[model samples]
Target: MNTAAVVADFRTYPLISALGSVQTLADRVAVEWADGRISPFHHVWLRDNCPCQQCVYSVTREQVFEIVDAPDDLQPTAAHIDAEGCLCLDWHDGHRSRFDPGWLRAHAYDDQSRAERLAGQPQSHLWRSDLQLPVFEYTALMEDPAALLQWLIAVRDIGLTQVRGVPTAPGSLKLIAQRISFIRESNFGVLFNVQSKADADSNAYTAFNLPLHTDLPTRELQPGLQFLHCLVNDAEGGESIFVDGFAIADALRSEDPASFQALCEIPVEFRNKDRHSDYRCLAPIIALDALGRVAEIRMANFLRGAFDTSVEQMPRLYRAYRRFMAMTREPRFRLMQRLNPGELWCFDNRRTLHARNAFDPATGARHFQGCYVDRDELLSRILVLQR
Candidate 1:
């Protein structure tokens, strides 16, 4: 086997440990690494992940072969560690597959290997009022890739970041947002104005006390990163307030387990309707990922619909709902700051709840432009920058 010729996916997997020995089993092959870690690679799993030209498209690097095409009882005829440290296998059906040691070790299903991979994943850093806000300069982020990566990482982990020294011009937010990726346009347009409007379709457009809530809870897929660039903010009493939704959720989980369970299990409807467009979403206010970690916090009191849960569970729902809302209002979790001109806030809309206090429009004018970028684009940009 030629080690140099072994091709994995587009991702480069560094060799962590050398392949020690190979043992063929009835249902799977047991592989022992030089690090003394034994991993079981099932027959179907290995066959499905073949990196050969016939199995995977070279250009796109996507799997072209389907596992269903292989025999249900397919088994490896011979398995051995080649001289080049590659796992060479011969199938009973005349199909051959070669696995690279680096890639194999990286994808090993052993307990220790799985745990290592999980620990390598990026983790969220929860914060409260005392958080030392992650602030970046607009010139640095716009000019240097390193600076942009740092700011994006802060948004990913801390869920809140502020950028100063931005251009105090209308539509300037688009240029900064495009640095991440294309803007996620909504019914409110690509860059929506955040000034008070008389005939405002949503409460966000009016000078009202908007509660701490995630944006666009009515959408099936809420926006990931939100950029609110303040062009002018001379109005009085319009202080921007933020609360770490993840922190509040943690407190709820600890102080009130039943409420947390109710909120996590119960599904509620959120809606936003106007004369032109109508959008509604029925989902749990709190969403957990596969690991049961709080993946998303979707809440918009103004846009919430009536509770239609079972009558028996209505009280539980209200108790959980009110407790969560109260936590958002807690001073300990609130971070109140006034954003001035040429400064913008980039935060995780699904993790950090934001609010605005009602301002007297007669005193002065406040104008802001905001846009959204999806989580897919954010992660892609981060990976590209890392590479």
Candidate 2:
């Protein structure tokens, strides 16, 4: 729709409590407040000042910026109301930003009121590691297309799923992920792949075995689910092992509160640098939910940088780290699977800690295609389906 229509639609809402009705003419618009107040101007002119960036930037450079101070030269010309009760405006500068009446009514009182991100889903429900992730009969998701979508949603919500009977190929994982939601375009695939390079970090993207750990611990925004499609499983010793890292953390908190408290207090840095890229993040070994529940345990020996611990803290940190490892090795928390050819293993990277059982490279090579989709997309799809 054009700017006029957008603005007209916006003005229908009761923006300011004192404003009642609005009228729009070609060159100007007028507003009637509850207390009989009116401001006449070209609605289009007024819309040019919409807080949204669509009014200010070119299509190629459409980024929103802070609207702290309105430029003096910018002035409203015309105004109108639309079906959505929004205040539409015309600006002398020819740019338009519709003042969404609903938005104004809700937020205009305080200039500093923060817009909070919608409350995120329950972390446990969004990152389940032990609840028997849905396994699909390879032919089902393909033959019953609707069911395939549902499976993808469930996987997205929990951050993983497993499938059997699909042929393992270089592109097979992509095909499955396409079914999951067109492969999220940005930050789209496996974090690491094993390769023949003596230095793994030097070639992190190539096929390689990974230890039990969460991906992107160092990243400010980590990718959600991980897909590993096994094309060839002839190599020995590369059985996939997953541990419920949250469960391990929870147990640690319950059995040894001091260790848990210590971990929460200490900040560990994770870093990965290569010839082309360098990435680093600092977070505690244990992450807790808003309600104080253990949310995630980001422990990766490969990615861990220096602990930066003082002599007094080293002994406690070491003790806690050792205890965590001991709990992780316990059988009850682990689910082991040798993803053979034609098998796909997926998991919530945020909650499940995965490891490789040291495969023999001499026998044959193990090849897998991997990808990822964000957890938010997955959960949204599920809720949509439910509704």
Candidate 3:
């Protein structure tokens, strides 16, 4: 326990348990934790992950050594639990490698260990019409790192949140949105005005009852985070609507598995055309990650192009599409509220379907500014703050 431990990345891995023993096997190292969990680390895996200054650059914290440069049979000569509870390996080529026990446990590849890690990860809190919305103040988020982290976590898990006490000024949203990362610019521009206009390029700019749908599915990658800041809200009828897209997908899967698969398997086109630019993308209505989990839901009815699937599958696709649309309108899932001046919404664009009831321009002036921030930046900021 007299030695020091070094990590490879710009993150901290807390020591979960002490390393009980290290046994050198024929091709790998067997590590036993104090809790009696065993994890096997191959010789190549250990050598390739060396965190020393020679193997990893100190400033960038990136790997400098490549595993391919080592011999094919690069087995360690000896392996033991160091006094510091780290796994120290002595390779046949006189190379030394040490692994932090915490990092090792966090990355253990055993089935049991992997399952434990997966269970410990954050999960979405599926909500419905009665959801007690997560709310934060704009001043606290900009001033306190702890507040910022909490707000971001809510956005990640709940997929919908609101911020009040914001300045009712044009472009005030840019200051708060930048607290996460850069504003994702589209053909519409960095900050798109959400007001009724005579010549509106999109339904979003008109005073119409927009249906519940995700935004900007016409692009190859939909925007991750969306920010809608209200600067003026004198309108009478434009109430906000929100539905948890993931919750609907889950219910659909349970109620009608066949329809769920249809949406996930069929690919459709979404296009956005204006005098300035034309954007098109072909993707499934429901996108699944490698693990087959619902990673994203892309649906923009206004921008959806004519279905071009084979005649045989056309009826099936339409049935699934109609069923999904029906689920979105179900009363059990919708959340309705009217945002006032100095309030803004920050939600996951990929998981939360948002809409607005038609407002009368003759009633009063209504102005709101909206912007987007990619998911990568939001996750990165969370990690840095966690560190």
Candidate 4:
């Protein structure tokens, strides 16, 4: 066959033959054997993108991760090829990982095929109040346990619930948290003996006056639900206030649509710092789930920090934040309650926003033990209950 004909045939039937020994697996992609034979053995495993800590380490300050020290051209070593054709890599910091050949090839092909699904799925209901706070008719929840369950369901749905009959005592809140599985550990445990003084001191662990907000926004993975069982009720001005952020957000969307758009689009910075560590996160103030349903409302002035944005963006963000704060403070948007002991009030941290009025420092002491369970866990339990 002439050169042109041979070349044409090779192009049409491109095949690898055992007759030619394999050299370096060139760039570590798939390898084909004779005539339409493909081997799963090809892989470019340990690319520099692995997230293990050895590949990245903090500098002397321990606050920032440095890929390498200065004065050294410590470029990350290329991934090593193993006998099995897996890509093996040991990062400069001594973290190691192996990439599966087949998985690498599969991932390469998958990039175009798989798009991010979305943040959430379709739900039966979206929780909201006319203003910011859910309107709870005491008659609805106080009358009976079954009615209370309905309110609990609402709280479960919206991420906030109200209780009417909690007796005043430190243990009262604990009892309420116990009625349902009070989520324990991490930023949430049974928080009790928490004094108003803690708030005065600005201590997050044991504080009062938890401003109009959601809890734990600075966490990369935030806890889902917060249950605060109010054990004491004698204090004046210390009414339990609840706000439906979703409701307020929806209203904003309907009213001054520009303001609502600004709130939804801009990123708000939340930060928490103490002597030991500091955490900061930048997230949109109005968070929505898949299907465009309102999910969580996160607006905490105390937790917010200075952000990196243009001067023009700042005014709109500041305006939206102020407007939302104003609506949250509105009495109409608030559902007030004096939770007695035996009432375990749960709120979806992702959806509902909650705040409390300053309690009289002398009206006995206001103590509430609280905990968090993931919203997923709560919903799973609900599903089991439905089943």
Compare the candidates by TM-score and give the number of the best one: 3
Better of 1 and 2 by lDDT: 1
Go through the candidates in order and give the clash count of each. 0, 42, 1, 14
Model 2 misplaced stretches (Cα beyond 4 Å): 1-133, 142-146, 149-160, 182-210, 310-312
Ranking by TM-score, best first?
3, 1, 2, 4
Compute each candidate's TM-score over C-alphas: 0.96, 0.62, 0.98, 0.57
Worst 10 residues of 2 by lDDT: 109-118
Q: What's the candidate order when arranged by decreasing lDDT? A: 1, 3, 2, 4
Off by over 4 Å in 1: 1-5
**Candidate 3 residues 1-387, lDDT tens each?**
222338877777878789999888888888889999988988888888888888998888889999998889898887888777778888888889888888888888989989998898779899999999999999999999999999999999999999999998788999999999999999989999999998999998999999998999999999999999999989889999999999999999999999999999999999999989999999999998887778899998999999999999999999999999999999999999999999999999999999999999999999999999998899999988997
Over the stretch 89-192, how does candidate 4's per-residue lDDT look in tens digits? 54455555554443333333332213321222324344433424333434444455565456556667555655655555555555544444565565333564
Q: In candidate 1, list every pair of residues with a backbone clash.
A: none
The C-alpha RMSD in Å for every predicted model, in order, reads 1.7, 8.4, 1.4, 14.3
Name the candidate, 1 or 4, with the larger lDDT value.
1
| CA lDDT of every candidate | 0.92, 0.64, 0.92, 0.56
TM match of model 3 to true structure: 0.98
Residue 84 error for model 3, in Å? Answer: 1.8
Global fold similarity of model 2 (TM-score): 0.62
Ten contiguous residues minimizing lDDT sum, candidate 4 = 1-10
lDDT of 1 by residue, 1-387 (tens): 233356746566678889999999989999988988899999999999988888988887788899999999999999998878899999999999999998888888888989999999999999989999999999999899999999998999999999999999899999999999999999999999998998999898888889899999999999999999999998898898999999999999999999999999999999999999999999999899999999999999889999999989999999999999999988899999999999999999999999999998888999999999998899899998986
